[model samples]
Target: KSAVSRVLSGKPTTTPKKKPGSPSKLDERTKRRIVRYMQANIGVTAPSVVASLQLGVSPQTLRRFLNAEGASYASLKTSPPLSDAHKASRVRFAKYHLDNHTDFSTTEWFQGQGVTTTEWPSLSPDLNPIENIWAYLVKQVYGPDKPNITCKAQLRSRLWHAWETMPKAVIGNCVGSMTRRLTQ
Candidate 1:
């Protein structure tokens, strides 16, 4: 085999270096804003966000920006723990849907991925981290919406900017709560 071929046959590889002069793209400020926006709405609409920023950047640019930060938009809007109220709401909704729809079943829905009705805690609302997170996010993400959100475009823009600027720590903290929940 050629020397290059022999080396490839079995060897540990070193981490590759980032190519120099790659697009000196979006900065941390913009990345957080996107995350904040997503948090504000508990969801995000891509085109609306793009227009709001008016940064003349493409979704690809925003995506690349996230990728560079080792995070993605999906990571920001993960499902938080189900508090009693939230769980009860979910169960009620599921039950109503089940009764209304012959094809649906509560057991199946409850047992689906990341869901477990058996784990529902009583008299311990704190056990549900998602509840706490919603409270926190509502304050930071949606606090501005109360005074006034002029228009859809403006709202969209503001959310995008907020999401782009949201701190990784905040996202990390909320997501991390899931870990503690699962472990217990």
Candidate 2:
């Protein structure tokens, strides 16, 4: 009798709802699309590029959406820039060329060699041909969903297989595409 009485007693539960005036929550597909676009455009730091994509999203709206998802403009600015280790490696590698005195050790040596180093402008992965390679691999592995992958390990393994089997001719094609901007 006591067990039956306990089973009949339960507390009500409620799910929290969005507050009024908040931006509508972004869907997962939309979020993934935005991330893919961002990855490809990692080279072009211009807000206008995002606006022009016109995936029903304004540049400011996209910016807010990215911020909400934890990406920032600084990510593009610092990408692929030489780290201290890379810089040191460059300096060390120059030692082998000392016979030419065109090394990067001293400012004079660099200037004498007609070598110039400057800060890189923010990059857009869209401008990079390698970004296309990554897209191609992703599409080959996950295009239109033949079946739902059960786990992250299985997905990763498939992606690795796709990457390994990517063709050299395809890489050449992507590299050739770099000569012209399709967006322009």
* Model 2 per-residue lDDT tens digits across residues 45-72: 4365555555665666767787888876
Tens-digit lDDT track of model 1 for 1-184: 5778757887645567888885655666776787777557654556677787765778777666657656545545466877899989999988667543244466577667557545444454465556765576456556855567677986777667666776778767877878777776
In terms of lDDT, the best-performing candidate is 2
The stretch of ten residues in a row with the least summed lDDT in candidate 1 is: 116-125
RMSD of each: 31.0, 27.4
Q: What is the alpha-carbon lDDT of model 2 when measured against the actual structure?
A: 0.72
lDDT of 2 at 61: 72
